[model samples]
Target: MDQMMETKKHNTNKGQKLNVQPLRTQTDIETAKFFLSKNKMGKRDLLLFLFGINTGLRASDIVVRKVGEFRNTKKPYIVEEKTHKRRKLNLSNLAEQIDEYIADKSDDDWLFPSYKDRSKHLTVNGVYRMFEVLGKQMGRDDLGTHTMRKTFGYHYYKRTHDIATLMEIFNHSSQQITKRYIGITEDEIDNSLDHFSIGI
Candidate 1:
């Protein structure tokens, strides 16, 4: 059986929830990028990976994007599918790459077109399956569509240590939820306990 199926079996036997975690380390992130660049849909997969980690957009929103939305725009506007909130994406970090990726494409083309039908966008489940293979290659079972968004949150928080800003970015109600969502709380707990002693 495949790693994904095996992971499901293991979770079922252990009666534990299957949690999708972020790529917490830079090395792991680089590894993911390397592997994604070698996938069958190398360029598209790499662009999607960069887009997700950079924008923190959900898989649904990212998949539905059109080349026109980002073309010649430094701050592309979008209304999130899940939140229905309109916001502008700061594409300064991705402008050069996006320009190159979309240079040959028309404005109406889906940013992440389906392999079978270029007219249609790739599905969220398709993104999940792609990440599943990436996770298996990375020796991790806890990775899915949310991993990209969470990876963005994790690294951003580590750099800025600004939970309030991250909460706003995620549209989360509380800082605690944002911390836990990005595994920050869990990481802190693990780090604190790693050096704890009871005078034994």
Candidate 2:
């Protein structure tokens, strides 16, 4: 019955267009963290949320990670599920927190374990539902699991202004797609038109 319901929910969302956007401001990001920390699986969920935004990894990749992969390591690596590309994550910022989280756990333990089954990892659908509820709490109808990846791209581009590096990071085909993916193209268009004048 539970599996059936999960399948139904997945099917309902499978073909729908994703209109989600990144948490475009620091306040929005912080608020998301705050709300995630107060959730039922507060610490685990918050850590998952942090890992997502911090590493720009997809939920599928993030949820399947094991504690040994990250513990005592400043550079945890993975082969991206979608692209099948090997990427080494620079986790210097998260090293301490990750170590603390996994301190008592076995090396084989899932980083984000299922709430119902400790031996199993959290599913992607589970993460989707978590972000869905988080979106509602934050008054953002356009939030989803993808928001973390997009948020990472958005802020990285903002700080570095190096689209080429980000493009390689995301493995995107072109700069336009990368720009649009992170919601900066729209912001640029709006900013250009906001002060446009034809001398008329």
Candidate 3:
């Protein structure tokens, strides 16, 4: 039996809106993880979500990967399907999860294979639908596939506070673009205002 076919069933909401936004906060990310973890048939989807936020890979590149790509490696690399850029990621912590997720599967098996058809990997739209299902479950109607990438960028900037480095990572033309892309402008403004004083 296929890995996804052995798990319990899940029902999805209907007529969901397609407009989506980033996962945004750590709390929101955790909450989404919690919900996904509860679904018995969602192991693959859960891993896909984690890999997305951690590696910041676009859904296109992420959905096409095989389970064996992450074995026994501290630095797993991927070529961005959209920009054709090569990225090497430090994901040693993810090795255990990858190992567990792919235990019974062969090296050639898709990490996130389609539930209905194991012969083909899940499509980008399939990933979008996965996020959409989880988004509605978490009352985050704005959450979309890009949320994973934005979450990575947002938290990366928060931790490093290095826009130039982030700009390079994201391949943006300028710090201004990086700031806006990661929603840092408002954060900077709010942080500065919080430190403002008028001789109190």
For candidate 2, give the lDDT: 0.84
Q: Candidate 2: give its CA RMSD in angstroms.
A: 5.1
Ten contiguous residues with the weakest lDDT in model 3: 1-10
Model with the higher lDDT, candidate 2 or 3? 2
The segments of candidate 3 whose C-alpha lies over 4 angstroms from its true place after superposition are: 1-20, 189-200
Q: Write the per-residue lDDT of candidate 1 for residues 8-55, one digit (tens) a residue.
A: 644554432257788998899899999999988889999999999999
Q: What is the Å distance of residue 51 in model 2 from its true position?
A: 0.7
lDDT of 2 by residue, 1-200 (tens): 21223345565875222566888899998999999999888999999988989998878889999999987789977999878999999999988889999999989999999999989999987888888888789877777667888899999999999999998988888888889888898899999998788976
Q: Point out the higher-scoring one by TM-score: 1 or 2.
A: 1
Q: Candidate 3's residue-wise lDDT over 17-65, tens digit each?
A: 4333456677888898888777655788789889888876767788999
TM-score of 1: 0.90
Highest lDDT against the true fold, candidate: 1
